[model samples]
Target: MASAVLYGPLFLQLPADLVLYLCREHLRPASAAALSLTCKSLFVLVFAGTRPGFNGGTQRRDLQLLLEKDLGHAPLPRRRVLLGSGFSIGYRSVRLAMNRHFLGAPNGLPLRYFDVQGISLGPLRWFEKWSARILQGELFLSARRTMCGSAWTDEALRAALDHEGPRYDICGHVSMSGPWSISNVTALHSAAVSASTSARAPVVLVPCRDLVEACGRCLTDYTTTVERRVRPVQGGGVDGRQTMEYWFITITSFHRLGSGRSPWDAKWQAFGGRPSISTIRLRRDMETHPPGAVKAAWDEGEQAAVSGHRRSHSSPTWRAC
Candidate 1:
């Protein structure tokens, strides 16, 4: 058998229209952004022609007409689900966009779910219809450890936090490669969406920037270094695991930062009493299921919509506390 990588089966052989259809239907918006940058053909097909079949003043109406003809009258109400591999990067903004869309426009909010191992995006608030609140933190630690090289200004971070309120449930999680020593994949497995302390409530973990400040050692040690190296490999090719060395260094420093303070010390205290920010861990059941499997526990209603076993109009499965 020829071991050569074949573009035939991978790209060339697939029908162009079929690929476009899949990209539109299944790819996340961020994924679409990335696909647009790969080459000219993809750029044209995915980006330039994204708004095809629609012309002039009635953009929304045109979309409705186009979708109705192609996907049928009883189109599934658009609900956004944020799926990604462990949210080590990019997923933060994507998930934030999903939340902002829900909070900004209550009328057509998408069902937002994060699919990263070990990281819990926080309690599901989309079902709850609650406003989100923001807790302050240091820039370096407040965001994910993977964002070491990122260039987000403090002003941008402040702007993102300024719009927050209690009506939307906002949850943030440490990426899989943070200083925290939790296994994202394993955590995903044990997470039970059955019920939180509150019945019919979504669980959200708000990261405290204040604690992130105290934990700046983790960010400085790992990211500030000039030299970069390949991920460490401990075994052979197939089963060989390559761990990013910089991430390891960050995690180590973060652990040391945590020695004195209890996790409960960092939390959004202004809301009377909510869960402490630091008490939240990057622990959730996010085991890799087959292509379209559900992660969080779902009720009969959510399950029906998820499994495509039912087709009726119903509100989303989130309600704010």
Candidate 2:
């Protein structure tokens, strides 16, 4: 019998159409990446199209249409808001839009803000029917575990907090099972500030309250503490440089039961319980500072920094409930 012949270099000379077919039919993303490194000829042939077998202009157009069609039928991102009492308020289909200013702001600031324009809330089953829409553009969702411990410890939550992406909102659902305390609320405020600083985006916290009696207290305390913490400062900089203002966080509370209903009203009512909803607007009086005073304070801070001792500012103090 004749010895088997091997054509090493000749294999790379295979028809481009055949190579494209093999890659499209057999290769997964990982496999395709590996195949791209096999040889220059195969690489060119395999990747000739933007997507597999889409090299020609007509073919590319057809592929683009197919992608659009598939995406049109894709499911929108849905988030489940569960209360600590084992009752689910419902899933929200987030509808976000770019806003010139923060929600309810008088004028647009230099920073970017994406408003949570509206949210579709209803029975869990209702979300299934509206699966075709894309609810979020570039957003992150953090849901706390109801069993025990804090939500800040979750890895995904931490990463989302630290992400340095374009202004993307961080929406969090916090459910507390244990007794609510000032400490828990403080931790949450700190986490929101950290996330706002890291992502340069506003955070919207939606807390699920199980304690009907403590709902009002929690809302007041949490809102007040966060407002004070994120309040605009007149000064505090090194070497006379202007201090950049930090982003603000918005805390949305749902009304337990009343003549007025929030978007989530139906869902909360379905669970046979009233939920607390409050809109606490941050006082604008503390929102701005006199330019002259701000400049003077920074100059003073610079003088202090130049001296032997540097001044240390304390964290915002809050009264415990």
Q: lDDT per prediction?
A: 0.29, 0.30
lDDT of 2 at 234: 55
Model 1 error, position 241 (Å): 58
Model 2 steric clash pairs: 253-277, 254-276, 254-277, 255-275, 255-276, 255-277, 256-275, 256-276
Candidate 1 C-alpha lDDT tens digits along 1-321: 142254523553468888778777996554554565566776686667453333354543433322321211222333323222122222222223333343343322132332222332422111111111111211111112222212223333223223322211112232222223322211111132112325555332222221211121121111111222345556643456554332111221111111111112222111111335533432222243221121111123335556664444455698799
lDDT of 2 at 247: 21
Off by over 4 Å in 2: 1-14, 17-68, 71-79, 82-183, 187-321
Q: In model 2, which range of ten residues has the least summed lDDT?
A: 125-134
TM-score of 2: 0.19
Highest lDDT among the candidates is held by which one? 2
User: How does residue 184 of candidate 1 score in lDDT?
Assistant: 25
lDDT of 2: 0.30
Q: How far out, in Å, is residue 84 in model 1?
A: 36
lDDT of 2 at 121: 28
